[model samples]
Target: MNTRAGEAEAVDLQVQGRVAWRHAIRSLLAQPRGSIRMYSPDYADWGLGAPDVIAGLDAWAIGRSQTSVRMLGQRFEGLQRDDPRFVQWRIRFAHVIACHALPEECGGLQECLLLPEIGLLVIPSEKSRLAIYCSGARLHAAVHAFDQSWEHSTPMFPAHTLGL
Candidate 1:
């Protein structure tokens, strides 16, 4: 994507595949006080498939205050049973991490991070991937879209279990 507001103009690089995914996750973790909203088929799959990324996200939760991580996707019942990494995470950081149901029509996001200062969208093809980071004026629009999606989402965990 073009950096219309000169936000990411200095960096014209686009990392692909696993490298790009790692970079995107790391960037999301670096944000001190922002929410992370992602959509996927099975959000819990990340915990099983990417150990390092899951660890980094847990670290982010322990260090950051007043932040939220919302995962919008199909219901992941396995998170409580089969996903040990996320089971541990929910035990300790359940307050900051929430899973939401994505509408059938929306399907899921390729990958997205709508932070306060930046926005990231990950596009993938059969052969490769493209990750885009947006800043400046465009970032505002991304955040707005995330807010709108978040409003219609319902919690994946039961109301009794959500600490916050």
Candidate 2:
């Protein structure tokens, strides 16, 4: 998934599993004024790392409010079924944290993380997970692309908790 052409440091993270993915996401997002964009089928594991990710955002928000995380996901079944952690995080950080449902036509919009500050992107590699450690200009383009898709997505987040 290191689609970037020149000098892209991409690391496959499939073997690294959820914990590693969680820690890397948590650590990179530690500093403030950074943006995170994630696209996953159901965001199953991202919820597992909610504490650290939210903590990072909390630290990042120490003096500012504009900083936040935007997620573009597909299925809401798993997220809505029994994941209370994700529910809680979504509620607590409702203002700075938001989730949107991207249409199926937006193919390849699944299982990726875009961290602007460190030029990082975590993507799937067919048989593995990928971590594009540093791809400065490339990440910006991806971020822009993700934002465009975000604009078209519907809000299925707290709405997941609607009838409860």
lDDT of each: 0.61, 0.64
lDDT of 1: 0.61
TM-score, one value per model: 0.67, 0.70
Candidate 1 contains a number of clashing pairs equal to 0
Query: Which lDDT tens digits does candidate 2 get at residues 29-99?
Result: 55535666777778666554356655766666555465377878888778766566556656666667678
Give me the displacement of residue 81 in model 1, in angstroms.
7.0
- By TM-score, the best candidate is 2
Candidate 1 lDDT at 86 equals 56
Off by over 4 Å in 1: 1-12, 30-32, 44-55, 63-67, 77-83, 107-110, 157-164
26-135 in candidate 1: lDDT tens per residue? 65654334677666555432443246656666766886555387766666676556666656665577677777776767544455666666666666667876667766
Query: Worst ten-residue run, lDDT, model 1?
Result: 41-50
Clashing pairs in 2: 11-131, 13-129, 14-129
Where does model 2 exceed 4 Å of error? 1-19, 47-50, 62-67, 80-83, 159-164
